[model samples]
Target: MRSAAMRDEPRVTDAEARRIAFAAFVGTALEWYDYFLYGTAASIVFNRLYFVSGDPVVATLAAFASFAVGFVARPIGAVIFGHVGDRRGRRASLIITVTMIGVVTALIGLLPDFAAIGVAAPILLTLLRVFQGIAVGGEWGGAVTLAVEHAPPERRGRYAALPQVGSPIGTLLSSGAFALVSLLPADAFDSWGWRLPFLAAIPLLFVALYLRRRIEESPLFTELLQQQERSSSPVVEVLRRSFGRVLVGLSASLLGVGGFYLLTTFAISYGTETLHLPRSLMLGATLVAAVVEIAILLAFGRLAERWGPGNVCVVGGVASALVAFPVFWLIDTKNPALVVLAITAGVACLSVPYAVAGSLLTELFPPQLRYSGVSIAFNLGGVVSGFVPFAATAVLAASGKQSWSVALLLVGLSVLTALGGAIGERLRIEDDVSAA
Candidate 1:
C-alpha cells in the first residue's frame, strides 16, 4: 500500500534528480574511500605494523581479523542509523555517518603501532575499525534511498546505480593512493607513507559534507513525513513484516560485498605474498580493475533500466560464476599481464550485479521502511562479507596456497547471488501486479 503512495509522489526535476545523484555519489565515494583504505592497509601494512606475531601467517590472519571486526559493527550501525534515517530523515543520518567515518579514519592514521604501544595498539585500532564499520553500515542504504527516491520511478535504476559507482571510485582512489606510496623505500613506506592515505580522509570528509549538505531530502521520504506514515521502529517493522525479503536482499548483496573482497583484498594478499609478485603489481592490478569496474557499473546501470535490475543481477552472477576458475587460473600464471587481466575480468563480471543491487534492494521494500530494510539486509550481507577476505586467506593457507579454493569460494557466492536475483525478480513481478 505504501509503495502505491510512493509511486504517486511528485517527481523531482531532471536537474534536481541529477544533482541528488551526483551528491550521493560524492558522499558514498568518500565513505568507501575511507573503508577501502583500511582494507588495502590491512593487506599491505597493518599485519607488519600492528599485528606483530612470530609467524608471518599469524600476523596476516590477525590483521584480517581486525579487518573483520569492522564488519561485526556494521549491523549495529545499520540498526542505529537506520532508525534515524527512517525517523528523522535520510539527510540527518548521512551527515552523522560520514562525519563518524572521516574522524575514525583520520584517527586510524595517527594511531600508534605495536612497537610504539604494545597490545594496546591493536586494541585501539580494532576499536576505531568498529566505528568505521558502524558509519559505513549506515552510509550505503541512505545514499541509495536518497538517490532512488528523488528519481522518476522508471529511471530509479539509473539513479540508484550512480551511488554504486562509489565502490570502484573508492577502490580506485584508495588503491591509487597506496600504489603511489608503495613506491617509497620499504622502510619509509612502512614508517609513515602508509599513514598518508588515511590522513587524506580528513580533507575528503569536508568535501563530502559540503556536497551532502546541499542535496535535497528524498521526495518519497518527505511524503511519508507529511502523511505521518513513518514507522515508529523501522528496523523492527522491516524484520517483522519483511524478513524473507531481507534474506533475499542479503543474498542479492553478497557478491557485490563478499565477492569484492575476494577479488581485491584477498587477491592482493595472494598475489604479493604467495606468488612473490611485487606489491606494486598487486596495487596496480587493483587500480586497473577499479577503473574497469566503474565503466561496467555505469554501463550496467543503463542495462538494469532495460533488463530490470534483478534480471541484470542474475546474469551478472552467472557470468561471475563462469569466470571464477579462469580468474584464478590467470592469476596462477604469475605473469603481470595475465594477473591484471584476471583481476579486471573478475571485478568487471561481479560489478554487473553490484551495479544494480541498489535498485533491486530499494524495490524490495516500501518507502516508509526502505532505509531500515535496505540497511539491515545489505549490512547483514556485509557482516558475512567482512569475513570473506579472512576466510579466503585461511582457505588459501589450508589448501597449501592453492588459488582454486578461493576461486571456489567466489563461485559459491556467485551462485547465491544468482538465486537471490531470481527470487527478487519474482517478487518484483508480484509487486507490480499488486500495485496495478
Candidate 2:
C-alpha cells in the first residue's frame, strides 16, 4: 500500500496514453448519448408520451421535475460509485457506470407510454432516470481520471479535455437525433418516433462497452493499487480534506452547468414556450450551437495545454460574462441571423469553461480519492444548479415577466460563472499525487 505522501512515479507511454484517450472519448460519448437521449425525451416528449396527466404543462414540469430528481440522486450515486472506484478500480467502475446508463436508457425506450400502460409508464420512466443519474454520477470522475492520469504531466489539460468534450458531442447527437425524429407525422411522433432515439442507445452502449473492456486501467490507478493507496472511504476522505474545494467546485459549477442546463435542456421548452418558436427553428439553432461548441471546446483544450486548464477556463468565463447581454439581445429579437449568432455565442462561451473544467476539477485531488472527489464535486454541483431552468420557469410563472424576460433573467448567472472560473484559474492545483 502506498502512503498519502508516496513520490510520483511516471510510467505512461505515448501509445498507452493514446489508447486511454480514445477509450475516454468513446466511453464518455456513449455514456452521454444514453443520458442525453433521456434529457431530450424528458424535456420535449416524455411529458406528452409517458405521463398520464392530461395537463401537458403539468406533465412537462413533472417530467423535468423527474429530471431534477436524477440530479438530486447524483450525490448519493457519486458517493457509492466513488467508494467502488476508490476501493476497487477505475476500470471496473467505468464499465459498470457506463453500462448502467445504457441499460436504463434503453429500458425507457422499451417502456410503454401513458396510452399503453397508464401511470406505470411515467413511473417506469422516472425509475430509469434515477438509474441514469446514478450511472452518470460515477461517469465523469472515472473517464476524466482515466485520461488525465495517463497523460503527460505537462499535457494533463488537453488529455482530460478529451473526455469532457464528449458532452458537446453527446448534446449534438441527442439534439440532432430528436430533431430528426420530430419530422415524423405528429401522430407518428406521439406513437413511436420517440422510441427510436431511446432504443438507438443499445448499439451505442455496446460499442462503448467493447472499447472500454479492451483498454487497460489507468497507470496512476494501477500505481495506487500496487502501493495499496486506495481510499477506504473516498467520500469521507474528500469531506475531511477537500470540504472547501468541494464548496468552491459546487459554486463554480452552478453557473457553468446551470447555464448549460438552461441553454440546452431548458431551451427546448423555452423556445416553445417563451419565443413561440417552431421546433425546427429552435432545433436548427441548437444544432448550430453544437457545431460551434466543437470549435470553442477544441480551442480551449489547446489553450489549457498552454496556460493550464484553470487559466483557460478563466478566459472562457470572462468571455461568457461579457457575451451574456449580447446573447440575450439577439435571442429576444427573433432574427434568424441574430438567433443563430446568439445561440452560437452562448454555447461557445459555456463550452470553453466546461471543456477544461473536468480535468482541472479532477486534478485538484490525489489519485486515491480522485474518483470520489471529482464525482461528488460535480454531481453535487448539479443538485444545486441543475434545477435552474425549473426554478426560472417557476419564477416566470409568478412574475409574469415575459417581455425580454428569460434572456434578461439569466445574465447574472453568466457573470457568476465567469467569477468562479477566474478564481479557479488563479489556483492551479498541481496534478501530482496529492496527500492521501
Candidate 3:
C-alpha cells in the first residue's frame, strides 16, 4: 500500500533532526530579531525621528500606523513565498526570505531621518517595513515546516517547538540591544545610538544563512517532489481544500502573535507615557519576560508530547485570559519589580500556546500544501496582530487611558485562541478517523 517514493525517502535520524531544528532556530531568531527591532524602535525612536508631529500622541500613532503597514504586506508575503515554498522547496523560500529581511533592515538603519529627507523619510521607512513584513511572513511557516517535517513523527512536537523558541530569543536579543543603547544620553540616543540594533542585523543575517545552507531539504517535501505531487498553485489549492483549517489556525495563533504585541509593544508605550516609567524599565521588563518565555517554551514543548499541543494551547489561552487584568494592574502600580513580574507572568502564560503552535498548524494541512496553509493562516493572524499596538494605543486614548479596556482586549484575544485550539483538536480527531 505504501508508495515507493515515501518508502525510498531516508528516515530522519535523531542527529539530522537536531541539526535541522538548530538551523530553524537560528533562522527564525534572525527573522524575529529584525521584526522586534522595528517594533522596539517604532515605540521609542521612530515616532520622533521619522513621523515627527507637533503632538506626541499624533506622532506615536503615525509611527505605529506605519508599523501596521507591514502586517498588511504579510498576507501578501504569505501568498508569494508560500507558493514558492509549496511548489519549489522550503529551503529555497527560506533563503530568499532571510536575505530579503537582512538587506531591508540594514537599509532602515542607514535611512535618513525626517529632518534630513522630509516626507521621503517616513515613506521610505514604511516601504522598508512592508518588505520586512513580507519576509517574516514567509520565514516562520517555512522554518517550522522544515523542522517538523525533518523529525520523526513522535518527535515532531519537540522539533516544531524549536522554531518557536526563536521568538523569545529574538525578543531577548532585540530588547537587550535596545536596552544597551537606551543607556546613551537623550541627544545621542535620538541621533544615532538607536541605529546600532538595526545595523547589527547584517552580521546576524550571514550567520543565519550559513546555518540554513547546511541543512538538508525536508524529507517530506522531497517525497512530494519525487512523487511529482507538488501543487502547481498551493495557495489556490489550500484555499479551496482547507480554507476552514486556515481560519482555525488563524484563531489558534492570535494570542501568541497579537497578544505578544499587546503585552510588549503597547505595554512599553503605556509604561513610558502613562506611568512615566523610564524606557530602561520597560525594555528591561521585556528582556526578563523573554527569558521566562524561553524556559516555558522548552518545558511546554515536552509537555505537548504527553498532553497534546492542542490541549496545551487551550489551557494557555484560558490562563492568559485570567491573568490579563492582573498583568495590567501590576503595570499600573509603576513599581519596577512588580512591573517586571507582571510582564513575565503575562508572557509565560501566553507562551504555553505559542510554544506548540508550529506543530499544531503543520498538522492542519497535508504536506502538499503545508507551506501555504501555515503561512496564510499564521500571517493572516499576523495581519491583525501587527495593528494591535496601534489599535490598543487608540483605544487607551479614547477611553481616557483606562488600562481596563486594554485588558478586555487581551481577554477577547485569549478566548479566541482557546476556541481555535478546541476546534483544531476536533478536526485532528476527524482526520485520524478518516485515515483509519
Candidate 4:
C-alpha cells in the first residue's frame, strides 16, 4: 500500500478548479452539440435524404430508427472507455472520447445521401451513429467525475452542475445552427445547409482536445493510481457489489434523458408534421427553451447548496410530472408564443434533476468503482431513453397523431424519476443508519 503521506496531495486551488470546470464544460458542450445536431437533422433532414420512401411518415420513422441505433452502442462504450477511465486516468479517457466524437461528427458531413450511394447511405450513417453513441456514452461519467473530484467537498454540487450546463449550451448551439440553416430556401437548406453544422465539428474538435490536454488528471484518480488500488475489473466489481446503486442512478436519469429528447427532437417533428406549424417556429421555440434552461440549471445548482440535491431534484421531478399534460396542452394551441412556453416549461422542469445528477451519482459510488459504476448507469439510462423519440413517434402515429398519448408518456417517465430518486434517498438513509 502507498504511504498516507504520498496520497496527501494538496487540494485543488480555486483557480485550478475553475480551469478544470471550464474545460469539462467546453468538451462536453461540443460533444453534445455534435450528438444533438444529429437529432435535429433526423427530425428535419435525414428522413428526406437518407431514407426516401413514398410515404413521408414512413421515411421519418426509418430515420428515427436509425437515430435510436446509436443508443444500442452506448453500453459497449461504457465498458471500453470506463475501464480506461477507472484504470488509466480521467484525462486520457476524455481525450479519446472527444476526439472520437469530433472525427465521427465531421465525417458525417461527407457521407453521401441516398441519391449518391443508394441503400449504403443510411447504412453508413447508422455505423457513424454507433460511433457517436460510443463516444458520448463514455463522456458524461468522465466529465462529471473530473469536475466533482477536483472540487471542494462542500461545493461539489455547484461544480458538478457545471458539466450539466453543457447540455443546454449544446442545445442552444445546435438549435441556433439549425435555425440559421433553416432560413435558406428549402431546396438549398436540404441540399447543403444541413451539412454546415456537422462540418463545424472539425474546428471544435481541435479546441476541445487542446483544452483537455492542458488539464491534470483528477486528484482522486491520481491518488488511486499511486496506491495501486485500481480494480482489476471495475465494471464487474460495480455490478457485483453495488448493482442497486446502479439501478438508482439509472432511474434518476430517466426523465432528464427521455423528456429532454421528446421536447427537443420529437417536438420538432410534431410541430412540423402534425400541428402544421412552421419549421422555423419549432426550431426557434427550442432555441428559446435551451436558453431559459441554462439559467434554471445554474439557479438549481445554487439551490442544491442549501436544500441538498436530493430534495431539490425530488421537488423538480414531481413538479415536472404535474406540468406534463399542461405543457402538451400549450403546444397543442399552435401559437408561436404558447409553443415556446411549452418547450421552455418542459425543459425548465428538467433543469432541477439534471443539475444535481452528477454530484448525486458521484456520491453513490466509491472512488475506485466510480468511473465504471457511473458510466454503466448513465449510459444504460441513455440507451433506454434514446428510444424516447422513436417510441414517442410511434405512439403518436398509433394514436392517430393525438398529442395526449405523448404527454402521458412524458408524465409516466417523470413519475418514475420521482420514485427512483426517492428510492435512492431511502437507500442513502438506510446506509447512513447502518453505519451509525
Better of 1 and 2 by TM-score: 1
Q: lDDT tens digits, residues 12-106, model 3?
A: 89898998999899899989999999999999999889999999899989989998999889999999999999888999999999999999999
Q: What is the C-alpha lDDT profile of model 4 across 248-305, one tens digit per residue?
A: 8888888888889999899999999889899999999888888888888888887877
TM-score of each: 0.99, 0.93, 0.97, 0.96
**What is candidate 1's lDDT per residue for 1-436, written digit by digit as tens?**
2466665877888788888999999999999999999999999899999999888888889999999999989999999999999999999999999999999999999999999999999999999999999999999999999999888888888899999999999999999999999889999998899999999999999999999899878877888899898999999999999999999999999999999999899888888888889989999999999999988999999888888889999999999999999999999999999999999999999999999999999989898899999999999999999999999989988999888899999999999999999999889888877887
Q: Taking the tens digit of each residue's C-alpha lDDT, what string does model 2 give over 263-315?
A: 77777776676777787777778789878777777678768878777666666
Which 10-residue span in candidate 2 carries the lowest summed lDDT?
Answer: 427-436
TM-score of 4: 0.96
Best-to-worst order by TM-score is 1, 3, 4, 2
Q: How far is 234's C-alpha from truth in model 1 (Å)? A: 0.5
The positional error of residue 377 in candidate 3, measured at the CA in angstroms, is: 0.4
> Which candidate's lDDT is highest?
1
Better of 1 and 2 by lDDT: 1
Report the C-alpha displacement of residue 291, candidate 3, in angstroms: 0.3
CA lDDT, every prediction?
Answer: 0.92, 0.76, 0.91, 0.87
Candidate 1 vs candidate 3, TM-score winner? 1
